[model samples]
Target: MIEVAGDSSRDGDWALVRLRVEGDRILEADADGLGARLGGLSLLEAAAVPGEPLAVDALANALGPIFRARRDSGRVAVAMSGGVDSAVALLRSGPKAIGVTLRLWLDPSGPSAERACCSPEAVLAARRTCHSLGLPHVTLDLRESFRRAVVEPFVRGYGRGETPNPCMRCNGSFRFGQLLDFARRAGADRLATGHYARIVERHGRLLLARAADAGKDQSYMLARLDPRRLRQIEFPLGDQSKERTRAEARAAGLEAAGRADSQEACFLAGDDLRAFLVRRGLAGESGAVVDDEGRELGRHDGFWQFTPGQRRGLGVATGTPLYALRTEPRANRVVVGPREALARRRVRASGRLFAPVERAEVKLRYRSPAVPARVEPASRGFVLHLDQPAYGVAAGQAAVLYEDDAVVGAGIISSSSAT
Candidate 1:
């Protein structure tokens, strides 16, 4: 049984849906408003809410004042991560800002969960920052939603031998979606965050752009955001570098200005993912570590212990260092080889395109430089032909497309091949 609950209010719609799925079919479905009969409809064909669709002109004329009033007040709901970046953003939002901290679920047994910005201690710190600035603060308890939307899918992806990037899913999809919903209910015009990324309008469409500080640019992590929601978001730190942000924090007398940055995956909370998986009942089964040609080199406790492009922790000694090329969950095998074996010149990905450009620079990993690529339509999504081979490209990682500094499209790397 699966329950899907969504708010269409952002689109001026509402829906409550309950479903029972057995195998790949929806056995039973009960939906109210726009989600009615969702069991048989393709997701894209489903209505945003259950009512006769209203004309854009009619909706605009009816709700224009309400929208204008929100804009007039300059009220923005800022997402505070209890860190220097977000605290500084709250300070810059002026007196009309409200601080919101999302209390998400974390592994209870993880040693440093309290240190994460989503933890209770971090939440208190955010509230203190708001109080100091004479702004109101609210905390939304989203543990259940966060687990279902981000954490569970991450564990499942790893179990299937894929190295999924959960941060992108959380920030671009669930986090922004939740924040927009909260902003609508709070009667605010827009939601703000401290991310080092910019939003801009190009050819009448709002799109994401790289921050002024390119080294700290987070536009790649935010590439999956729905373009329609761009109008209601604000990035105060987009044009500011980390150095200047910290300096401003000191000038404002905020203690968090000197606080260290948070871990890459906040839910990990400084603990290893392997331990968390074990506690979640994904105990590793002994497996064989083999070369790409099926020559057994040594043994591993679990195939899930390895990720594509990983260069360390392989117990096998083959004279030369071996990098993990890929994991085969079905065969219970980990494939290791020379670093050159990981290079690939072509990639296939599945996801929607934010723009219709046929050619752009594609980035396979966050830290990897964007390489010139020829993009083309594919069966389910799109294909990328890189100008040069990239090393360590992995499935389940985002392939974000860019034209100059603007993000035009994004998708998951479903598979890759060496030229």
Candidate 2:
């Protein structure tokens, strides 16, 4: 049975909630009718502690001092990644910042095991840093939501022989969207992140711009943020160099100042995904790994072992180099082809998250240079006409759009077989 446990003061001063995430877990409820009344709350808080009384006023006061202090800069909800970037963001934003870190689930099985933004250790580190800086820290338990929104899609995408980019989805939609909801509920004004991207008003329209540090600029990964949300967000490291950011963090004496950078997709913690997948009970019954035209090249333990455009470790030693081009889930086979087969000049992206405007830059992958493209609106999606064909455009990956360097919007790459 589902239940909720919470404590509230006489005036509803503070509310502490304990939630049960799974069906097997029991959350005790106050049956005395004296339980705190959870009335109307914004959708964001509702996702966290549902059915709780509205503490809107309290949330407001809690956010008031910071907003007032900013006077010019405005209040911001900073996503703390338990690393130097976000740590410095929190310090720099000062009173206007509420540090938040999500505790995303780490699947025992998944490729590229690395410590992600969500881990017990990472959460604790973020909390300590926030407390040390005299700022309140909140841990948003988004494990279930994350699984549905990211992990599940990743697995399914891979199964379909596509490459997925969960970071774009999490950053552009789930994470920031939730933060904005938090701001509205708490009466805060804006949100911020340690991303090396910039936000500026160009020609009266807010734009997501590139950061000064090319090496650290994450505009590509964040190309999915809606243009409408730009006014309510901040990217402080945009104009600053990575070295200067470190210097600033050092000058502020933050613990995360010297902390090593967390690699992409922290949930994996460096574990091998194939093993994890097997542990998760998706062990393979051996499938055929084939070359173009249904020619059997070798065999794979499972279809999950391959992704679109993957070129290494094919097990089969063909005289000519080969790369994964597709996964035929129906046949439980992975399709391989020559390296030249990866190129594409046109991309059709559907279920797009934002509307397109004129010519923009399209990024095929993170850290990949932005390619000039004319993004044309296609129903609920978009069609990217690239200046030059881009190779390795995986269907599950995101086709993020940019104009003048800011992330305007993004969508899943539905097809990139454009010649």
lDDT by residue for model 1 (339-363), tens:
9999899999987678878889999
- The runs of at least 3 residues in candidate 1 whose Cα sits more than 4 Å from the true structure, single-residue gaps closed, are 1-72
Q: In model 2, which runs have C-alpha deviations exceeding 4 angstroms?
A: 1-75, 108-115, 351-356
Specify the poorest-scoring 10-residue window by lDDT in model 1.
Answer: 60-69
Q: How would you encode candidate 2's per-residue C-alpha lDDT over 132-168 as one tens digit per residue?
A: 7666566566788887887776666666667677787
Per-prediction TM-score: 0.82, 0.78
Candidate 1 local Cα displacement, residue 348, angstroms = 1.2
Listed per candidate, the RMSD to the true structure in angstroms reads 13.0, 8.7
- Which pairs clash in model 1? 8-13, 33-50, 34-49, 34-50
